[model samples]
Target: MWSGDELDLDAYLERIGLRENPLAPGELRADLATLYAVHRAHTAAITFESLDVLLGRPVALDVKSIEGKLVHGRRGGYCYEQNSLLAAALERIGFEVTGRGARNRTRGDSLLAVTHAVLVVTVDGEEWLCDAGFGHQGPREPVPLGRPGADVEQGKWTYRIREEEDGVLALCLLRGDTWRDLYAFSPQRYHPVDYVVLNHYSSGHPHSSFVGRVIVQRPGDDVRRALVGRELTSLHPDGRIERRLVGPDEILTVLDREFGLRLPDREAEELVGMYLAGD
Candidate 1:
């Protein structure tokens, strides 16, 4: 429950590379331009990570703790923390934002639980689907929820919104010649406790990907950077790709140098060592 005062708007704006303005949400147009700038700036600024879960660090989604870790401490988080922070920042700017949880259909199983958070932002009666938390395959701009089949291109990547007969909307990314589902979401708003439940499962469950490996990602100039366990991938604009496996000794170096995350040296060493050993 963000009361709008929990997040320091000035600190948040500076962290996300936006200038602080006294304009209220009503004062600024919720048009595509404003949405795009904010969305891009945010995705560009923060890394999508789950290192705390690996290190047994208590992850809290409350506004105060979120500000301390992400905005102030300069660490990153997974879906819940990322979206919660994004929503708070949006509310501060006067965007009519609602927190919604979605099933990750990217793995091709519709039976998956609601583990991802997204925002349905309304401005001037028009609603757009926004999720800056989706790591490498996420949209850099908002997807107009009204327009199905519309494609959003970032560099060489193409994304679209697929609406099913049951009224569920799935964000899809084109992979090679096929369209891959990113996630399935609905219009229903979710409460804060819902995320607490999902976050617990995501962070603690042995079957969850977060617990199984070390995942880190951050947006680059025209590339999207992602590190899965020891594999680091750099997806480029023209579809050319570069891939490398980081050695055990260089785990923290890769995380810090590439992802801009500076976990304590001892913790980074132990967490990565533990993860590899467990795997």
Candidate 2:
């Protein structure tokens, strides 16, 4: 179970900018429309970042810890933290939510380990891929699992779930003319404990990509932006990318202004020091 009962539902909803929306149909319901709205709003409000991992801090997967850091503290997190919080919210709202472990496919033909966490929600007998933690190029709304290979449009971005061999589903994004694979997941259901294992490897292992670098991503309707180490890349939907170096002196400023992430003074100073030392 995802410990939905322990989560502060009001605070979580408010953090995602959904509690005050006038268009909400009375209360949150276990339906497709509500699922779509929650997914869209969550991905828009919370960013995808690995700051804590880079800072050598343990990434906790408990709903309460996640709610405190992400909802109350107004900080961002990577896949496990992001999707775990989301799964708890959806489960609290009475939807059928489950977890899936996925492998990153963006790094060409390399066979990477399954480290990413995603959620599957079932609404009225229809299943949807509700992943709010896939970083900048991730889908803003739920991708239909029933209809694989169908193009689903979220704002200006297009995404599709392709059925691969052995009951595996690959999530792909349209980059201009190419439908590039983002990640792939099998049918085996993963639990929170499984994520804790994946989180450990990702947050502390020397081979982890998030272990030694600053990685932050925000998906937008027009342009998606990512800050990796000292380089900031802005990706447009038309396959155009603009890259620039962010100096140690301005890293904190860029994080606050560009990514809407303002860390505490002490953490900010430490991060700057890391960049200054070229770590």
User: Against the true structure, whose lDDT is highest?
Assistant: 2
Q: Report the error of model 1 at residue 223, Å.
A: 2.3
lDDT of 2 by residue, 5-66 (tens): 99998888889899888535358899888898889989989989999988878888888899
Error of 2 at 177 (Å): 0.7
Which lDDT tens digits does candidate 1 get at residues 1-279?
A: 544567887787778777654433445455667777778778888889998887777889898899998989888888889888888877776688887888887675648878898888897898888887888778877788888898877667787888886788988877667787889888788877888898999989988888857789876657878998778999765556689988776777787888878876677778767756755
Off by over 4 Å in 2: 23-26
Could you tell me the lDDT of residue 184 within candidate 2?
98
**Could you tell me every candidate's TM-score relative to the true structure?**
0.89, 0.98
